[model samples]
Target: MLPALLRRLPRRHRASFFRRRMGAPGDLRRFLAIIMMIGCVFLLYMFWAQPTSPTSVPLQTFVPVVTSKDSNTHYAKIDFRWTWTCENKRCVRKESTETGVHVSLTTCSMLCGSSMLWPQPTGPTTLGSHSVSFDREQLTFETTATEPARSYIQYSFAMFNSNVANLIQLQKNEPSATPQRDFNKFIVKVFVEHSDIVKLTLSTDESYKLILRMEGENMIGTVTANNFFGARHGLETLSQLIWWDEFASGAGSLKIVKGASVQDAPKFAYRGLMIDTARNFLPVESLKRVLVGMAANKLNVFHWHVSDSQSFPLVLPSVPQLAKYGSYSPDMVYTASEVKDLVEYARLRGIRVVIEVDVPAHVGNGWTWGPAEGLGELVMCVNVQPWSLYCGEPPCGQINPDNPHVYDVLEKIYRDIIELTGESEIFHIGGDEVNLECWQQFRNRTNPYVDLFDVWGNFTVEALKRVTKANGGKRPKHVMIWSSNLTKRPYLTKFLNKTEVLIQAWGGSDWTETPELVSSGYNVIISHVDAWYLDCGYGRWRENGGAACDPYRPWQTVYMHRPWNGDPVYRKSVLGAEACLWTEQADHVSLDTRLWPRAAAFAERVWSDVGTKSIYKQEQLSIEDVYARIQMQRERMIKRGLKNEALWPQWCSQNPGMCL
Candidate 1:
């Protein structure tokens, strides 16, 4: 009907008719006039009679837009802008600025509180407003009876430090002044709902959930965990999310990007790192630092290679003479108290201490333990004897299998170690590289009563039984051994129970032994030497003229390692992987450089998805993008007192994407 009426009337007449009928002119000019009048009323109401509705406006637009002072300037400037929303109609904006701020608890508290604007309700119909402020560095908020309180929770920086001291201790190298400020303080808000005894159990779901929303003045963040261990991990991740910007405000500040959320747990139960302290004695303090590094990466197992042919640095109370004779020096041995301290420290970081006593084959140093103990001639000297009489390797050794006293000594050693490192369910009985010559001598001594293979099989079986029997009754939850036993001597399986042992597959990359061990129903931890060994490339330890292992194992190689790439059925038997650092030439000076960044790569490989895209990949991220992230983490570690090797030139690290 309207179309017919418009068609019957002229264009000029149609406008007048519609205006008369609708009580307003339908022309664009008249319509615009009405809108202008409404806008004027709104502007007047917003400028004069501000409503009680509360709103927030970023301070960037306010005058005197107090820019952040240069970081090195020792003074802080804060600018705040707040909006008062009135009845969903008008909003009043207010600004405040504080310059030349000093660093003090009282000052910080005042600055935090002063950002808020208290709104006053003008009329009886207006809603009640809030008057919020902070005192004593604590945020205090109060709302009127008509308004529901919106709590502005302010957590003490000291409280945050205490909550994550285990992690903070990693940052011991950080400057003493405002150390917490090294990382963004607002990235994570940790809340513990219940105070339960936090024991580091082997539960995969030691529940933790983190949520981050990047769409505000401050990125709102929350971390919820069932236990303290999970909370520690969440905080580490929050730290990882933070990026330090040197130019952000002159000196430097940590910044967290807008949106991210991660609910993480170890996919495999035994993400680990093996540090060989026996080959070249590492200081107790250095080992503790390594544990801190491992915790930072969320790697839980510290596979301590405590003893080897080169040295027996672990001081056992039952066999005190071992350290006296076997250790490189008196100062190098780990005392009982120190061992306990290290174990406790690891436990607090959710790391389990697994001691590796590489036996029989690597027991050349055991001969020095003492002749009275009958360990003096445990194995023939590899270098001093006829090749056929000792072992395959140049430096060969083995505990005399024919001696009954050997088993007795083994039991004592195992019992003492188990007692000292409390709650260790897995003990590594190093059964790798037991040359045929050593067993042949045992066969010759026994005179056909037992063959060479039989001697080796018997020794391994007896060692497992002794270690297990010492730990209460049943076999230890797991006994880790090198892959050579399962691969080279398949006959040993006749006397072995697959469930009681964990095969550490450190066979060089070319060796295809991991799958067979896994298929045979033994759980495995892949430490594939060619790929994950950090001690490689420096040179083989005992080789003449320092034989080099060629190219060093870079972080990329460690990151590319996939422990369960073959035989899906056997994948379940694959417990996890570890990066083994044999400290043949390493000492305190080179320890951090040898392990870090590269070890960190292994940590990410074990913690994150196998197929996570790499920055170096084509059409993906630029090299600098990934390099910067890793470098940043490395710098954080260095600040925490870890001496890390530089990944690239300083210019490349400082300028992201510029290296490419």
Candidate 2:
């Protein structure tokens, strides 16, 4: 009786009865109600927080350069005006167009229809009716539409603009009260074909017209510029647009897929190639042909090795004799207009032209002065009796930096180079291979070891700064030197701060053996010869009885070689990589034969992920097949009336990689 009574009371005394009741259906209903409330909150937050995809709405842009009533539009010029709105209000914005009109010039301003350019009438001028305008970030062409003989017109950005930066900012911004921040998608539409007259229908499916669409909530672009074009036209055109439809379908010798679009951008910020013209004196057209190949692979920077131990092609405005005496031809030097044309061509392709005037060491025969204590025929002593005349003999001249006049000559030459190249920053003044032995031999009896080497290097730096400052400021300029100078690190450190310079580590044989120079706190560009040097012939050549040292590098080797062997050197400083074409076995014809197909491989390696392990992932092309494609493109260059096109190998039965 007591136990029964205790059990009945315990259920009441311990509160077990209430707790047990709570664990039943009634409690489960309450737990499910709480869970449903949490789920609702989560779904609501997701609905408000998630980003939207880029808008699918069609956005078309066109910059019509000409609309002539005469029905003959061969030479007719029309300025382009184009624009698009962002569906992703969060994206930043930037853009450029080509209308063959220099809006900056004072002579041709009539078409502005706004304050973008001052009004002017000159040189195949456009009348009032064909005016263009940019209003509220929208580009409008106010010309009457007509039947154009040519169905397509195209243009590209002439210079780098802040539009891309703006687009980025816009994309990153959250929805706010601001007009630009109210959206989620970014859409850019470009028109590939159009009639001279406005049509009722502007769909992409039209026979004579097409639209390229790109949409992104957040977008980034990688741009490349070559020193040869210095204009960055290929990138600009890719950034903008170019149409070859004026030529017949086959006449243009190019093809595009219908309704095909790509969200394309560069993998690396700088994709570059260097050509040593000093050794083999190539024609200007040769440079253009090389640029054409570079553009195909999206290579941007063109490092022009204009001067070396062999010669100097630039005609300094201050000192005209260099062009007359130093160049391959009297009129063969790059004229101001010719430079502009090259710049324009490269600008169309989005390439940056970087000019290299190798100095102090490889100024060639004309710049050799100073003492000669067995400093070889090319090197001149820096100290004793440094002031000398060009005797029309070997070892003719060396600019004595201490003599003020020599420094002046150097300054003038560099300034002229800047002005001729239109003062694009990032200049290369070669300060390599100075023979201290010669300086010691040519010692002034009065001041033994007058510290001239240090003084000369210091003066060169000052001279470079002067030219760079004269053009713009420090931000626009970069001074690049070979890693061989790392051996002279003490000299470099003593003369100039390391921050002001870029070191190109190109000690092919010695560099790969060690990584000390890169780890030593210097911004280094890797061009390791054993791996990256395109000039080294491939393995098959040696198999076929070629010189053992002179192995040919097929495109595969270039595609596979890594810039760094997982060294800690990258953590300290590393700018990027460059592919060099030494002219020892190169001219115009052999240049493409050797450089092309291989250069394409280098471009891919440098631009793609450095950690990418597989070379087989790329287009599975044999060395012979690669050359065949290059030949086809080379033929296209020839049809464009380029003289250097003749330099490409016309026939090669044997595989370029295999001697057999």
Candidate 3:
């Protein structure tokens, strides 16, 4: 089309016609072309003359700019002149300009400040007394305690000395070590204030008053408590109070302020951490490390989920075949001696070890000893041809509640457990997910009178009786069960007594189960799976490959949980809350990282005041403050040989406001 149109006009006439139509004639076009060439040359010249580096200009006069200093830091502004190059068609020249820039200037050296305590004290803590310092070689401990606390005092001192040695080693080994003066000699005085020595019983008092005063060269630290347990708590507080600081000289020194006083006690009687060792057997050493971590956080109850459908690792002398046939390996079992040692280890750290032997539901391994050993064919075989009649999971089984031999075996197991872990007043008879279908299937093969409820209720009742009878008529203070036992079958209450059975409300369709159980006239321990189950977010145990729950719970979510949110009327029935770690996806390698920091959140919630809400909201303690404390606590755990996961990058921890 264009060619045809151009062909219609003569070539010479087209040029004139196009030039006229285009709004420029010969002289104007030539003048415009010259202007365009000059502009291009000017731009090229400017590009060539551009400075490769920033230009600096000297100040004509010394002018000081003042800035308002904040208590946190100081800032300053300075004005200076600089030369900038500009090019045009006519000429190129440099111009000097004055401008002010603001900068933060250090007014004083950054020094270490007082550190915050973890599982922060529930009572008042005041600082205003004398300052005390300690050197690794000069520290000494003395105890003035009642006869009952002598052993505890000795143990506490040993732990304190060990911690001191660890801290010194950490400071020396750390890459950022600083030099400071060698600390002075200090004395720690432990006094049992109560006249009558309290035995280390289940009802032992754990409240304590600690006063640390600095008196000139000699620092006097006193821990006064009513019982040995309280004194142990005081010792933990003393350890937390002592922190090391790096001086400008680069040397590390330990110090405790002279006039600091702390009167503290746990908000709940049962601040617990439930560890499932049955899924992935944790060695005795790993279990001890867990206790140490729990002790550092002041968690009192170590709910040892010792057995499940997968394995039974606790060695029972009466039921020797259980561990022999069920454990992952012979070495994986916790022998009777090892159990005692672990119990004592936990006792020394002021933590009670509660053994959990999940019966009926999670007892596939319990059936391994065979009917020859008086064990019944109580559960349908998982590998049986007709899979529809068996348990939910492939290769799973429940204890045969109908078989009289099941009770006999339970009696022996409970007796052995009671004899082994002597101090614990509570035992967890896991009554969760009993698989009524399995029981129904088995019932078709037996008498009709023995239905699922009858078997379960009778088994639970008999087990409770056996535990009490085994304990020399001194029934365990509480035999805890899962919420499903009571919630699903309220009629089971007739067979189970509220005074004897404590309902651990967990794995509910919703979080309302705790309040519902408490309102139903039952003592409850809130272990809501959504909020307190530490193992959920990791992943499904044996699934194809996916997280068990979406949006893995962060530490903040764990911190926000309040066990008794719905009803205040049954709050007293709420014994406490526990953080459960089901180890389907967890083993020794990933245990510490998976549990700590997040579990610390639950620890604080259970130990702090009941009214303490979410840290996100403005309360007496802010979330930022808690974050700082927890970060510091995480470091302390690492120093104490706990392989806790880091909460944030080191830069964020060192520079507080940067991350927030």
Candidate 4:
């Protein structure tokens, strides 16, 4: 150290200093003193000039505190993305001064709060940067409506509070939060023009407009709709806009984007989800959960396909014998009172419960009691052998059109359905898979000259009349029938009334049935078997069973299908669509998994009525664009206790672009 210091010194100084160090003990002490003095000066210089240590913060780091004077200073007005400095894991929004990193409030919200929406609003919408936090317990509602519909609005407000679900924050302890700008009370109010509408039908106006803004220390929300259904939908959209912020103060701290407007309505009139509980019974609680899921997604029709060859679970008060002799067990039956309650439950959720008693074809076990009760051979070939030769699938059964008693029995079932649902505007007389051979073998023994197609077609005609009679001799304006051999070619127009029947095309999209039905002037609900069937591809439910519809339909297939495109008239004839969940491989156990997020995909399609090509080219949104949105939808469904299935890995969800 002394030599290095001497080398930097002037020539005369270096010589003088070295001369003093040359004398014995006294010289060494002088050298030591000189070294200590130089080292002290060097230490002091380093202390004054060394760099500052960075903070060990998790989310944000501390920046130089800008003084009060800086607030008055003028800076360049430029657009910059919102960034943050992590001061102990709190993502405090900051304005950057760097070249390109300077920025937006949306990004900061993405970190601390999420504003992602589902079934994306179909009309004009504006999202603002401001936010307000609310205490969930302090949420209240006010409205201008009469008794019938006001109750719906009140129930929906409570649902809105619960649906403001907490974002999943995976941590052991709560960290410090930036105290939010609080709203003293989150007051909501609604106005409905047609508050008398207690039932939601195809005619019900389900369009709504919502405006949210801050007022001094509180927030006021305004929802205007034509009916309670639309108002309820507005509330659902509002719920989507709010999320639980764990990083904010209070046990129930929730944040929402302030100063927003939305106008929304379904693009198609009948956005539906068909749950085939007949194949395998679903619990009432599970079905109610399904209703909640549908409400969240803005799906209107719940096509409850309650009967088939495998089981007769719905106990009709007119014919208790059917369920008595036919049900797998007594507890499995859906009682008349239960059906009434379910219908009411669905109605309150703004969903129409269209109970389907698929006649002539998907009727077997329930009809066996007919002959035992002295009705002549009601459904022949019940559980017939060499099943493929007689029916579409195993456990072969078909209602005997030859028996007058069969149609009489069907009339009672239809009457019960109409009574229970408290809905007679539309009926779903399911006419899916009809086995000709099942009836043909029985008919050959009686009268071989009868044409099978005419007989099948006639059954639908008679059933429609019976259901019409069931509705106090007034025909339902629309009757839904599943596309089958009878709905194809010459047979379609020959018997099925184009004015009254709606053919739900479940044939392959490439098959021309959807176009034919539309071209023939019959309205169609597009549930193309290849595209919209959710129950496909779980593998054979039985040994070498119904694999005809195998190869599972993923969410992508469900989202992009548009069978009635290219013509406005054709699109007009296209009523809407349904995602059918046949319970061959799904039941209460896997109900949520089989239908959800995928069904939600279908929900957006019918609601927005967007096409795959249009979304890709015109809108410039590929499948990747929808992945995150649907993921958020799935998360919301889970928070509401929906148990929705995830089609992506957890890692992929956290890191978005990397997965793509």
Candidate 4 has a TM-score of 0.81
Q: Tell me the whole-model lDDT of each prediction, alpha carbons only.
A: 0.61, 0.47, 0.69, 0.77
Error of 2 at 80 (Å): 46
Against the true structure, candidate 2 reaches a TM-score of 0.53
Against the hidden reference, what TM-scores do the models get? 0.68, 0.53, 0.77, 0.81
Question: Judged by TM-score relative to the true structure, which candidate is superior, 3 or 4?
Answer: 4
Query: For model 3, how does the per-residue alpha-carbon lDDT over 44-123 read when each residue is reduced to its tens digit?
Result: 99999975421233232222222322222222223323221212211112233334221110000011222266777767
**Local lDDT at 617 for model 1:** 34
Task: Indicate which candidate wins on TM-score.
Answer: 4
RMSD of 1: 25.1
Model 2: how large is the Cα RMSD against the reference? 28.2
The candidate maximizing lDDT is 4
Question: lDDT score of model 1?
Answer: 0.61
Superposed Cα deviation of residue 465, candidate 4 (Å): 1.6
Candidate 2's residue-wise lDDT over 110-220, tens digit each?
112111100000111112212111111222111122233111112332122221221111111222322322123222222322233221110111111112222253211
Better by TM-score, candidate 3 or 1: 3
lDDT of 4 by residue, 302-340 (tens): 999888888888889998888877788889989888888
